[model samples]
Target: MPVYKVYLDQVFLGNLVMNYAILWAAAKLSRVPVHTARLVAGAALGAAYALAVFIPGAGFLQSVWFKTVISAGIVAVAFSPVTVRMFLTCLGCFFLASFTLGGLAIGIIFYLNSGRLSSWDGIGKVIEGNFWPGILLGLIALWAAGRGFAALLKKGKFENLFRIPILINSGGKQVRVEALLDTGNQLKDPMTQSPVVVVEYNSLKSLLPEQVQAGLERDGEADIWNILGSLSESSLSSRFSAVPFQSLGRANGMMLGFRPDEVVIERQGKLARPGRVVVGIYRNKLDPEGSYHALLGPNVLELTG
Candidate 1:
């Protein structure tokens, strides 16, 4: 008879980390906001499930139905308030990431030491005590693969305009809004050469001064110009600028632009700062359907970290 010793701490900790990674990857794939504390709590739930097999009367945990329920529970905890479509997408990505990583680890372990690999119980057993180095190397490989995949996607079918979440912070005020990445948008501030992100005036209303808001509420280029001229004597003169643009039915138009303290774009579970960017205020709605409130220039995405 042969015996296998599984460290309980390793089982809990290993599954915890693995669960977190899978949840994060799934969130990125589903393009949803990530809550770190919720993810950690969800991972803890998964780790608890992994330990249930050790209990005397916990045989029900091994059933396929029970396993499905647990998986759903994990996702619900991590990404609550998701629609049915989004929930399905998140679950699919979760399974895909889990299978891909699990299969890769198993293949590598088998290729290295087929004789030592016998029965797979918990994830800790697959990692064992001596396989930490291989795991670390595998993580590095996955990261490189992810970067390459992102580049390929950019040039692939996803090159078209897509919605993304962005945060604009100025004067200790931050506004989070959905923005469309427009490849056709090449608008930039002529003075500083910073890319201009056109946001609906209502979307940025909270961040603007009372005088600026008053001017934006009115129509016509004359009022906009008046506001720009008036701001020179105001305290916000340094933060304001003029961005010239040409659009359909409008030529040589100027937009009210202001410099934000910081702009952070979240893509694939990562925060990308596109250096300095100007926020252009548009009095009218950019999208009639209200799908997105802001427009992002392609160059900004390229400069993101």
Candidate 2:
């Protein structure tokens, strides 16, 4: 057996520092609103708990359930007025931030002590090497990473980070795809002048008749409007439309469009329907990895709000 001792003042100080770090990291990573006074008070309360739990008669504080409740209290005080879903999201980010900071601290400590640890014989010294430097460096690295991520989000690619599920119901046949919201998509229906969602040929090909698919395959998009005309006799006649546009290195281009009976967007456990939108068919893959099968333009994507 080994002897163990913890000082009250040390526990209080350590917990204060750690709680603030965790709170800051979680807020930055999770994008949760922060009230400075509330957060500071919450961290202080957490530190008080640390000191309180170490008191000689505090046996109940050692239980896992008690600790979990304590964590919830700390989070609630720090980020008040948060929805349950958002609170859970913040809690997950808190855990992630804690783990990442721990790993970062440990890695820096190990790196700083590498080859110089030959004189030390115990695990305590190995794990506890140069605490202040490790903490300072870890925090600096965290801040830098947060800044880099924020910069990336500001680069007009924020919409591409999340994939939204959209269901297209045409003539009773429904096709669903994960859509990447593209800010650069300016394609719109020339007639109604509504927004258009660009989808791959393969994904929406099932929504078309076999004859139309054969015509598109034969003439390679040149006969897409003709194919839509032929589909006039089929069940998918009115669902088909066309759009004309000009792009880089190409002039006088046309894309096949589909006017589905209903277009539903699934996001955050809610389904939304947007009006005056057409689906544009793309001949090639928007993303080669197939991470998202469809691309949503701003005109229609805003309707999800």
Candidate 3:
């Protein structure tokens, strides 16, 4: 009998690699909702499962069926409300990756040992220097492959993959909100031709002047152009404008617009200013679920560039 010593540190590192691989693969395969914190937690669970092989009474976990169950738990931890089809696909890909890596490691180990299969007997009998090196090399190769796959996906569908965070500055105040990239929002400030970003009135009410806020809160019964005349003589009044738009059941109506002091998109930990965007107050919520309050115009991205 050979004493198989499993180092706890190695087990943790191994689990991290496996977890990242599965997540990277899934991101490449489809447009699935995922977050970094969940993936890290899932990786910790996987490392615990891998370390189970070293426990005296947990030997059964090494069995194929038991390992499959553990892997399922890992997948569930990493993604929320995964469909049956997606779960199966992820599991199959994990297995394929495992087998591929195992084969590659074994082939390299055998080649390094003078191509003599018999010299590298069962693992219990001999401890060769090349054994760990081969495994390390295999791990590195898998990480590189996973990263390459993710890079391609980011290049293709990067914008759709991430939620956009925006800050609207107006009237000496600033409000932050999430926004959806909306190409259909071609409404603009009629006077300056600047692009418009539509937002729910309630979400941005605090930033509006008290007088302006009270006037627009009447369920929009009064015409916006008429309400504009009542604004006080302030910089905020100068910022206000009327935008004409045609929507369902309404042929011609005006939405209240304001030239923001600055409209910025936070990307990659940096604030990118999209020059001179008008914020239009939409009486209705853009997202009933409240995932995002604003519908950002495609022109925002174009102007930022």
Candidate 4:
């Protein structure tokens, strides 16, 4: 048996380029912010994935769990957990790039070898002999292809369209809300200069009395006086304040209101406290099944101010 000498050549260079290209493509597709650190991390991951095959007794590294963990680790280091949308986008891009490159390699190998393409036994031998070279070459090729595809799509526009989840808190309960940051939701209470947080009536019904909920559903405006009279006796009555505002269509209805002890918005791993927010609970459903309880409209000044 003769040992074959493995050498890096133009083919290996081509593969390395491909690997970087794929990583760049993945980053763009996912709309994840890419920097030198992220690129380096992705490249390192690709190399590790390649090394997994050649290291004898490193069988554990070949498992699905190992691969997933490795990939996730790379993503976590590269992307921040700012919003669900961003996270999903990054993961989608990564998997898509990986599959595309792997498929391309398999296709090319099959085409070159024709009907005499190597079986698993022969393939394993080839991999074992030229493990490092193959890993480097394959990653480069995949990365380059991915980058080219990403470039064709244009990175900036794709990222601009990515929406992130909005975090809202009212009273003591916190709800993770998916809200499109609409610049058009400019509804505010003129007197107090407070941003009116709009919420569907049904969303907060769970927090209201059954009778009050039913009355709100049946008699909309007619139930206002009665509801207010009842609220006057409740513990929230002392804390409640009248916020007069006319809806787009509805002529009259008292805006049922509450003063949230505190309100926090989480974005990009940082918490923003927009205090003295007036939460308006409505009687209708904003969306099917009431996906959101309330919308944090605009900020209002505190009574002390």
- Judging by lDDT against the true structure, name the best candidate: 1
Give per-residue CA lDDT, model 3, range 213-250, as digits (tens): 87787763756766687775665678888888765227
Q: Write the per-residue lDDT of candidate 1 for residues 69-153, one digit (tens) a residue.
A: 9999999999886655567767888888677667666567656666666666544565665375555555555555656665664
Give the candidate number with the greatest TM-score.
2
Selected candidate, larger TM-score, 1 vs 2: 2
| Model 4 Cα shift for residue 304 (angstroms) | 35
What TM-scores do the predictions have?
Answer: 0.50, 0.52, 0.46, 0.40
In candidate 2, the residue pairs with backbone N, CA or C atoms under 3 Å apart (3 or more residues apart, or in different chains) clash, namely none
- Least well predicted 10-residue stretch by lDDT in candidate 2: 153-162
State candidate 1's TM-score.
0.50
lDDT, candidates in the order shown? 0.78, 0.76, 0.71, 0.55
Candidate 2 is scored at a TM of: 0.52
Which rank order by lDDT, best down to worst?
Answer: 1, 2, 3, 4
Q: Model 3 scores what on Cα lDDT?
A: 0.71
Q: Candidates sorted by TM-score, descending order?
A: 2, 1, 3, 4
